[model samples]
Target: MKETVPLSVTESSEAEALFHFETGAPEAVRAALGLNATRIGDVVAVSMRNDPTRYWSKALGFGRTAAVTGELIAEVCAFYRAEGTPLAVLQLVASVLPEDWAEIRAREGITAGSSWVKLVAEVDEVVARAGAPDRRPMDGLRVAPVEPGDAGRWASVMMRAFGMPEEHYSGMAAATVTQPDWYPQAAWLGEELVGSATVYRFGETAQLFGAAVLPEARNRGGQTGLLVARARTAGELGCRLLVSETGAETDGGHNSSLHNMLRLGFRVAYERQNWVWQPAG
Candidate 1:
């Protein structure tokens, strides 16, 4: 068995370095996607960005191994000091044990929320299908490479689209500017930032990290434009596949956005259960 090491919060750099070494993955890339590390007892717990079901699922398929338990949950909650957020707990489950979802809910004192299963779509398959397109077109939606000067606008759109608090956006932006693997593009209406998406390449597979559209920008095709652009970019970069995940519960539990992906040639590769445990009574 691979040895597990405890993480020390005070020594963040050391913890991050050790995590990178153990995973043989880039710290900057993980950090950019909000994958932070927290040490609990003798175990190191790393929380991937919110909605990590797809990320963990892909990792498992790629032969990575990890175990999940209440201890991991406690450690993640403590790391974020998010004892009051149900969503945070949900994200922790998605990141830690996407495959063994039933085990998570069966644990004593755990109440599963209206969570989601991860869905994936293949671009080639969608293109081959002759039917209604998954994504809608934006008449004048323009996409441009993110500029350092637009950090504040980009941050605002992320917060609005993802429902993230100010602090999380701040951390995400700080990590984004320094990560080479992250390719950020902003959607604009005239000069107003309306949406944004980021692409992260892991080996030959490119993962779509964050895709958010401001509430005001919804139904305007901002998201669809972003997805299509990213898919084309990923293909041009020599990636054989492009992947992303969305909440199965969103859009009245049908995942309307996922349908858009299907229209664009992505398919559901797997369904993962998202589980969470609140503080025991």
Candidate 2:
């Protein structure tokens, strides 16, 4: 059996390594976000890199982090200030830290008129099913191995599907394509490419990332089908589990589809919240 390491909250190089390995975010990005290394005990845990002030505040109990209802607000505020971006335009990826939410909100100082802060919860789950290898049996849907030259087109589809900027999609596609163990593929409906997903192998588990379906092609089972295909491919490569992140909030049309994934047998492993904060004007 694999030995379980105890969680520690200390500043250690090992903490930095674990943070980067788990998040897959660039080291420069980590530094830019001001990720601080903390050791919980024997295990290293890295604080969210997006805001240094909040990190210190939460760790020390002062500033925005002092308030129970304002942590999320504070964190978002600090993030925008550090990045020099408008609060409304920033997109935050959710992480599993509920105790810090209030401190984050207090830091942001969200008001009734200045800016809108939305608390989005994402459902994290693992794929329990595998894809069918007998492609000839399935009708109308064609799952093909993505070619090296098709990276650009695949990136385009991903950008549109996730509502992300072109740079992020392009960068991820380029990085994924060059990895020997990374498996990427596209889902075609008739002759049109509708969805795409990638599997990244990490030890005994494989993570499903970049799953997206074009707006015009959703609800035709494209996203779901692609997930199954990716899972099957991961299983074939000796991965025991496949995991993906989905939204839990239902305020938007996009989040409504999360119900479908849950109905398809994906259980919620945990819920993560994205905290936002903007500088005082």
Report every candidate's CA lDDT.
0.53, 0.48
Question: What is the per-residue lDDT of model 2 for residues 151-221, given as tens digits with 9 covering 90 to 100?
Answer: 77776777667665554325445445555667888988777777777766655455556678887776666
Worst 10 residues of 1 by lDDT: 55-64
How far is each candidate from the true structure, as Cα RMSD in Å? 9.4, 9.3
Candidate 1 all-Cα RMSD: 9.4
Question: How does residue 236 of candidate 1 score in lDDT?
Answer: 65
Tens-digit lDDT string for candidate 1 (214-276): 887777777777877676666667765666666765554566677777667665544444344
Look at candidate 2 and tell me the lDDT of residue 146: 83
Candidate 2 achieves a global lDDT of 0.48
